[model samples]
Target chain A: MDENNLIKMELTVNGEAVSMIVKGGRRLLDFLRDDLHLTGTKEGCGEGECGSCTVHLDGQSVLACLTPMERAIGCSVLTIEGVGSPTNLHPVQAALLDEGGVQCGMCTPGMVMSALDLLERNPDPTIEEIIEGISGNLCRCTGYKKIIYGIQQAAQELQAASPAGTVKESVE
Target chain B: MLYRKYEVAQTLPEALSLLSSHNGAVVRPVAGGTDLILQLHERILSADVLVDISRVPELRGIRLENGQLVIGAATTYTEISRSDLVLKNAFVLAEASKKIGAVQIQNMATLGGNIGNASPAADAIPGLYALQADVVVCGPNAERRIPITEFHQGYRKIDLNPGELIKEIRFAIPAEGTGTAFYKYALRKSQAISVVDAAVCVQLSDGVIKHATVALGAVAPTIIRSPAAESVLIGEPPSEDLFDRAAEAACQDARPIDDIRGSAAFRKYLVGVCTSHAVRSACERAA
Candidate 1:
């Protein structure tokens, strides 16, 4: 790699402050997968169209594949791994498993990120809203009906958990 | 990586200076990177250097300047659709932005990019043409404004000079009792490129249209204004017969070609249907 092609950037990823020397052309998806070994953020098309590399950048959902390292400077990135774990899954993640929203599991991570972002913006999204919310994330399996049910379940869980009727913050 | 070097500029002058300094190099300014990044990855477009202007504070806002609604070139579609000023002043533009793609693409795509890409089927360009938007271009030497009609030269071509960045897009707030509407026909409800798009702006006084503009996209090499239709609507009362006649005139003015999306004949037929519907919608809103 040419030294001139490298640049230093600071960003918070998954609640960790990361400052490193990365190629300016390196995509956020690659940086997370290759350098950090955070393979939960899957790459499907490697293009912006697939939405398989979706992640939350500063609380907004963006395609990690199209987001270059230079754009991530001073920003906060949240990947699928950051949202939940095996033992204690986030409401959306847990609901997906219970509702059978996962099949091949390739599009699961991206779907979770997009769903969390949607619920954060609109806590109680209708079936149509949920359909549009996850329209970017293509699921070849489950036919999306289960995924819609999963998001609705998660919304109910979040509403019940929060006595004040406000949904919980996605980041925990 | 496709690009050899990259630099993120903090300001408009810095971005222009960076582009100017890279003399003879194929340097492209990237804002939102929704299209550019994909083009570079697919080898459809090449660049020796990429200057990121997405973060330039001067190129990322929406505000009313004097009587015009000024939108920074880097302002994303999500912002444009959500801006109160844009919603109130240029509702057609907001509607167009919302239909560009799904939520993720909207968050990253910008109005400047839609113009810079110069796609014949760009959802936003039709609305811009109907609204009579102006393009603000700043280069190393000077800044100039180009009307949207003249801004596009040909297929995927723009009139922008080297080292010149699109700074902002401005369109006057329509007069009272005026209504504008946009309609797009695509392969899918979301994440689909437009097969045919139409936008209409109509101003009414005394129950008759005094001013009208109809712009159609994807049916020609560039988004085109239907002066034939506009002339038909002027001085005519809001009526289905008048709108149908105007739509027929707009269809006569369209020059579409056969593409995978649609046949030229089908697009020509759609031109009339879309125009009539858009005109009816605009007239209802005006009333």
Candidate 2:
């Protein structure tokens, strides 16, 4: 019953294979923030309602607060840091800033993660899809207009990037 | 928050063994920690020990066995929604899975945990009940099966014994020709608990209801089946008048308690509306 009898677990976080052992009930969100010192993964509701703790478990977005540390054993995880950086912003991240999507900054990480996963799965999503994609995340500020528009702008930018390869193919 | 003890068994046997040693403990089996995490932080539960079943490989994946689908306890809602078998065969479950929590919650919450948690409004309950689902559990002494109807003991209570884990949920395939639908009625579209939820399974032939199963959730302490409504519609042509009568009968079992979301009166109204909608939607699918 002593939770500290830890087991060394091998996991790939942000594309790097790592190992650790803390406690049996240590939440994945806590492990990321407290152990790995990746505090970008915020915890809001702790329950599944708020998406503030969103992270990617093997590429699909999931609430990190709800994911057990043991669930991540021998699996892959992608935090907000994994997706984009300030120096090299993902299209969604860039739009969030340009479109003024950040307000309180609590829900930005989850919103961006959701949008990134959405675009990867759906190259071009409708407005309904955009709304549905971010439905789980609760943003106290911004009224979500900027966030939706940001995702739309990011989708267009991604589309614009594809035409270059298409033009090159035609020339060849 | 106060610090609490946590335990992760390397193997399920060890976990079960730990449970026997500590009787009458508040230990919980965690797949997606979403529910437990909130319960712990809120002081609703001290969480003396969180048995991390997620690390066990045995509790994962979705597979078809014989005519039933065997879902591993750790298989996330995201996986089930994307599964071709669940999409094609268990469309109701797939639909329900999509609306559960959010994409983030879907990626962590598992079907077994959903049932094991026994939330009145858990998306999987009504659909699984409509499908006439069976739960498989592995405990220290033996493995046993319980029908979904008998699974929930009360609000936030399940019949599962201590030192036991939900192994899989199984349901038989539809007879020859049939279709199903799950309807969730919440004030908001997503990321909210249901005011009322309904699932309908109907098989039709010659423009008549050959058979039907109707189930409702969140309107009672436990998920309730509308045997009265189902009886009225079976072998009879589903007409507007009949739909109205069936809905009224189903509403009888709905014991909605007043809360912030809506008044008990509204939920009572929803029982009728959701039941009718679920029936109509299911009929359309069958057609």
lDDT (tens digit, per residue) of candidate 2 on B1-287:
22245456667687677666666666777777667677776677786657767656667888888988878877888889999988777788889999888877877788888888788888888988899999888899898999988878788888787778888888888765577888888978888899998988988898899999989988888888889878977997778887788789888878888987888999999989988888887777777
Best by DockQ: 1
C-alpha displacement of B35 in model 1, angstroms? 0.8
- Model 1 iRMS (Å) reads 2.1
Question: Which stretches of candidate 2 lie above 4 Å from their native place?
Answer: A1-11, A16-25, A162-172, B1-26, B55-57
- What is the per-residue lDDT of model 1 for residues B1-287, given as tens digits with 9 covering 90 to 100? 86888888998899999998876889999988888888888899998888998889999999988999999999999999999998887888998898887888999999999999999999999989999999999998899999999999888889998879999998899999898888888888788888888999999999999999999999889999999999999999999899899989999899999989899999999899889988998898888
Error of 2 at A146 (Å): 1.8
Local distance difference test, each candidate? 0.89, 0.82
TM-score, chain A, per candidate? 0.92, 0.90
- For candidate 2, give the docking quality class from DockQ: acceptable
Alpha-carbon runs more than 4 Å astray in model 1: A1-4, A165-172
Clashes of each: 0, 3
Q: Which ten residues in a row have the lowest lDDT in candidate 2 chain B?
A: B1-10
